[model samples]
Target: MQAAPPADRRRRRADLLTHIVLILGVLLFALPVWIVLMGSTHDGAAIGRGEVPLLPGAQGLDAYRRAWTEGAVGTTRVPVALMLWNSFVMAMLIALGKIAISLTSAYAVVFFRFPGRMLAFWAIFITLMLPVEVRIFPTFKVVSDLGMVNTYAGLIIPLIASATATLLFRQFFLTIPDEFVEAAKMDGAGPLRFFRDIVLPLSRTNMAALFVILFVYGWNQYLWPLLVTTSADVETIVIGIVKMIGTESNIDWSVVMATTVLALLPPIAVVVLMQRWFVQGLTDTEK
Candidate 1:
């Protein structure tokens, strides 16, 4: 073969290095999941005794079955299925609620002329500083007074007002050409009609992006749900996993691994399924 150019050789080397690094990164993350998978098939006692098996054991798949049907090993106050259901419902509600509210709020802030409009937008933006953790006490108090405590409403409603979603939506709305607004007005379309027809269609991608984020946020919620719910009836899968581990002595290593694997499925499924929409929403130049 003829000698290649230096630039071509350098490019080839860089590509090789990049692939190697990417493979390493993938292995770095995948290794732990592999261990967890293998460990889930072994006895918790064996694992507790410091056996770190990197391959599946003869324990079969009963851990997953027990986790799905029962809450965990020897703990069945709430089933994994039920907890998964609660988390799914909570996540869907929070994602949809945030999208709906942020849509309307951003529309008003962007298109409608009103008193203190900038102030209103700023007020909403300022809330980004105050997350649920910061205002947990008063938030819990309000929920308590409203009797929403331990209810799905309490679980979802408090967390649905997303300042980040509102900000992103407002910025996207700004990209919309004034000609569209003018055209809508010329067509005798009112604000609501214009919003329904023009803004919403344009916002579908952004909404998808936000839904992926907000759903995961709702799914992974720990503190808020822990404080809000006192019953297993409203238990989230995350909480169920925590309870499964328990203290060091009573920890069911195999079952915990199994439950963790189960818990990971939903968020992974969501991200994998909506990855294209998520990426497009964030990158689409059409806004």
Candidate 2:
């Protein structure tokens, strides 16, 4: 082979460095997950004794079965299946509800001129500064007063209004060409018709990306669900996992690790499935 040019050699060296760094980053993140997966396969006693198994164990199936069906021995007998279902339902509702409300809120703010529009936008923007932890008490009282505690409505409703989603949609809406609006008007489309037809189609990528993010946020919610749901029937997986680790005497590390794996899978699956749309939206928004 002919000798490579100096520039080409330097570029190749840079590429190698980049790949090495990327591999290291991947390993850094993946190692913990791998450990958890390995731990979940082993016996609870072995894990409790601080024995970290590097390989998969024969008890993998049994561990998962117990975690899914029976949960931990000393904790509440709520199955992991029920907790997963509650988490799924809560995630879907929060994602869909936030998307719907944010879209409409952004549409009104961006596309229409109304009284107190600035005021309304400011009010919503202000909420971004106040996190769930700050408002937990008042929010809980409100839900309790409404008799929504321990109900699906309590889990879903309070979390549906998201300032971040509204802001994202607002920015995305502002980027849309005015020509589309004029064209829609010339085609005799009304406001709602324009929104439903033109705006929604244009926003599909953004919506998909936001859905993945919001779904994960909802699924990972711990404090809010812990507060709202007193009944085992409405308990989310995150809370159930914590409940699994009973006092020091009864902690089942294998089952807890199995539940951890289960808890992580849905969010990972959501991101993986929406990876294309998510990347596209992010790249497009940067433009």
Candidate 1 stretches greater than 4 Å from native: 74-76
lDDT of 2: 0.92
Instruction: For candidate 1, report its TM-score.
Output: 0.96
Pick the lDDT winner: 2
Clash totals for all candidate models: 0, 0
Model 1 has how many clashing residue pairs? 0
Predicted candidate 1 versus true structure: per-residue lDDT over 1-287, tens digit per residue: 99999999999999999999999999999999999999999998899898888988988798888788876654555878899999999999999999999999999999999899999999999988876668999999999999998899999998888888899999999999999999999999999999989999999888888899998998999999989998888999988877777655777888888888888899999999999999999899874
Model 2 Cα RMSD, Å? 1.6
lDDT, residue 244, candidate 2: 83
Global lDDT of each candidate: 0.89, 0.92
RMSD of each: 1.3, 1.6
lDDT of 1: 0.89
- Give stretches of model 2 more than 4 Å off: 1-3, 285-287
lDDT by residue (1-287, candidate 2, tens digit) is: 99999999999999999999999999999999999999999988998888988899988678789989998888887889999999999999999999999999999999998899979999999998986789999999999999999999999999999999999999999999899989998999999999999899889999999999999999999999999998999999999988888566868888999999999989999999999999887777542
